[model samples]
Target: MRGQRRVWVAAGVLGAAIVAAGLWGIGGRQDAPRAAAQPAGIPVTLARVAHEDLTQNIDGVGTVTSLHSVLVRPQVEGLLTALLVEEGQMVEKGQLLATIDDRAIAAALEQAEATRQSNQAQLRIVEQDLQRYRTLSQRGSISRQILEQTEAEAARLRGTLRGNQATIEAERVRLSYTRITSPVAGRVGIRNVDVGNLLRTNDSSGLFTVTQMSPISVVFALPQETLPRLQPLLGGAAPVVAHSRDGGELLGEGHLNSIDNQVASSTGTIRARAVFDNPDGKLWPGQFVTVDLRAGVLRNGLVLDSRAVRRGLDGAYVFRIEEGKAQKVPVRIVQEVEGRSLIEGLAAGDEVVLDGHSRLTPGARVEIQGDAQALARRSQP
Candidate 1:
């Protein structure tokens, strides 16, 4: 019994020893990982904000419009014998565009001409008789009443000749109408009628349309609140520019033509037009484009790269670098020009992050790569 009790006590002691050894091994383990080292600062590009002369311009969407557009219609009713202009052909003012069958008009003109000639011949005979009668009266060989009667006959023949001449002029005008011409210098549009088609003055669809391409106009609108600034500039010949929607390509440059007399009630904007010399035909009619109207200049305006400005729940804000750390700074965007933004809150000489701002937070350590001010200093002589 004593030997068995000793054996059981030894077994309990052995088990406790093993369990304590395992616990010690885990507690004093030397292979465990250490706490992670602090992450390095976020790398970013920076630009030094500064005050510069910025143009206060208004940007808006605009539509291209032609200065003059006309529908070419025949003035006289006749069969279209010739089409002198083709679709999309540039034409000059008074250039012949079409020809009508003028045979009937020519016949009428010839008849009038013959009548005028016959009346002229009768007038000459009457004048000769009047002269002979006057000579006879002066010689006391014929009565004075007979001389006066011959004078009256000559005057009547002269009146008849004048009437025939007027008729001939009318026929000439009608004949001219058979040869249709462009009333303005422009590019011809689609042809509505072909040769052998009868054209009439009252035709709903005209022969064609002509649109003045060069020196074309663009119509746009701006907010009514901008009137105070735009109105003053309108009196002067302020310059306006048009660009592609992305603002990468310049469409054309022009000056303000006119502003609407009143603001639109529904839109709360005023319509305006600018005329551009479209010699290259870049600005086409009915094209929607971006319009930039230079109202005035804002001297000493704070500027920053447009990408630096970001929107959060609060509003527009920028990540500004201060003391090697990025700090959130609220900014009021006054204007955007040439891929840069004019901000209100930032001061001159302050640095702002341009790129890699997504991983930034307030008071975050930042390592700037492309510092614009630093590069400018390095470039200096």
Candidate 2:
């Protein structure tokens, strides 16, 4: 009876310990936290397609050239006596640029005039004698042949007088050539000759150069295919804007002046010229510039950010957001102006992805955070 009671007490203790461990495990399961669910959509920003008037432009690289360029040179040979204009001086048309020694020409002109006057006096005397001889011949005191010879002599003296007068005029013109003048209004370049330098008419170079800065011209070329579209804007004044090579500054604004008659066979391009009113002298001769030729404007066209348009093995496409999912939409790019693309195959109010497209695929869930209005607001100050 004592052994049986000891076994019952040990068994009771073991059973109580097991029951306590089971209760502790059940409480621990009830107290622990559950795992959170994964997000169903990706984070992305979306922008709505815009419909506005946009102008399409053709871009080209061109050089600023002078509208009027002249090389002042001596037409008569003499000692260069004076340089009236300094280097880099703005001069007007017909402005005196330089002078040569004119003493020799002046002296020759005077000699010619004196010879002409002396001949005129002798011709008058001859005319009087001829009249007397003609009257004497009528009275049979002088022979007919003598009268004829007197008349011939007077005619010869008149011819000689005419020749002398022509010589005087020639010398006068030669003297005028000694004074070199600017042929056109412009800023003068570096001086090639100094005062007292002997100049020749056949000099290969010139005394200096003058180039018109205001109302400058830019010469550029476009592919032959552009000529047809540019034809309508040719007769009329087409607008053109010029910028610095880096396109950071506005150089000037102008109109299309002319187009070449024939395309350059080697380049397969047609040359064009644009005129700018560079009153501030921003545009300079021989300067390389970026040219924008506004061909025409597309009215009420569907446009989007340039970055939204992507290229694949097929062509251009855009990732459009529809009902919280990305949908691939193929588009045709008509024109690109100022980072905005005029595209087809999309409505005016469609929402497209502007960025973060690499992580997106068709039917992929996305969370639209920003819209077009938000982007515009962020872009402003």
Candidate 3:
């Protein structure tokens, strides 16, 4: 009777295991269908359009320089006697900066004046004698030949007087050169020569350097591909702002002063320059800076954030949202400025996806998380 009970227990356990297996398979199939039915929501952010003026700009590295720089050199050879100005002093035009030893020049000038006076006295004496000789010759008291000799002497004295007068004028000019003056209104650099130093005319080493910093110039080179677009704006009446190398600070505002006639062969860049009013003397000569060439406004254009524009096999494109799906629309970027891109082939009110574009494609369902109107409002004006 105990053996019969054991067999019955084993059969009951097997039948229970089969029933449990059947329930587990049914639950797994039911969960799989539920997971497949879940909706695939594309996480995305969107932006709306607004009307604003978009400017195209070219960025380049440049250098600051004084509009006018001059080297001070002595016009005549002499010993430097006195320095009237200190180094790095602001001087006005015609301000006396230094003085050379004028003793030799003064003595030469005096000698020339005395010689000129002597020649004038001798000329007067000769003239008086010639008149007397002519009168006597007409009265038959002196020979005509003698009168001719007196006349020749007077002529020679007059020539000598004229030559002496010219020499005196030249000597006076040389004497005036002893006082060296600033040729331009600017800040004077370090003096090359001290007191009692000998200097020469046309010396290779200059006495000092003067640079006019009230108005400064910033020069830069732009890629030649932008020449066509830049040529028109060059004639525009708007001013352009220049920023520092980091692009955070505004150095000054200036107009397009000049552009080079030819492009650089090595870099294919066209050289350009701008002039700024550096009244505070912030910009210095030879300082490297960043340049921004701002072209005038683009009217009635669509500008998208730089992050929205993407590159693909078909060229540049942006994932634009239409209805409830992401529509990858191909766009042609006309220009980029100030972290925004000016593009075509997009309407004014189209929605542009600003974030979560990696998995986006044509007809992909999207859910906009933020206020699209707020994004558009930020770019207004």
Best by lDDT: 2
Model 3, 239-283: lDDT tens digits are 656777787778788878878989999999998888888877777
| Model 1 Cα lDDT, one tens digit per residue, 80-197 | 9999888999999999999999999999999999998888898888889888888889899999999888889888888888898899899999999998888889899999788999
User: Considering every candidate listed, which one attains the maximal TM-score?
Assistant: 3
Candidate 2 RMSD computed on C-alpha atoms after optimal superposition onto the true structure = 6.2
Q: Residue 303 error for model 1, in Å?
A: 2.2
lDDT of all predictions: 0.86, 0.88, 0.83
RMSD, every candidate, angstroms = 7.6, 6.2, 4.5
| Colliding residue pairs in candidate 2 | none
Q: Candidate order by lDDT, highest to lowest? A: 2, 1, 3
- True-vs-predicted CA distance for residue 248, candidate 2, Å: 1.4
**TM-score-superior candidate, 1 or 3:** 3
- TM-score for candidate 2, residues paired by index: 0.80
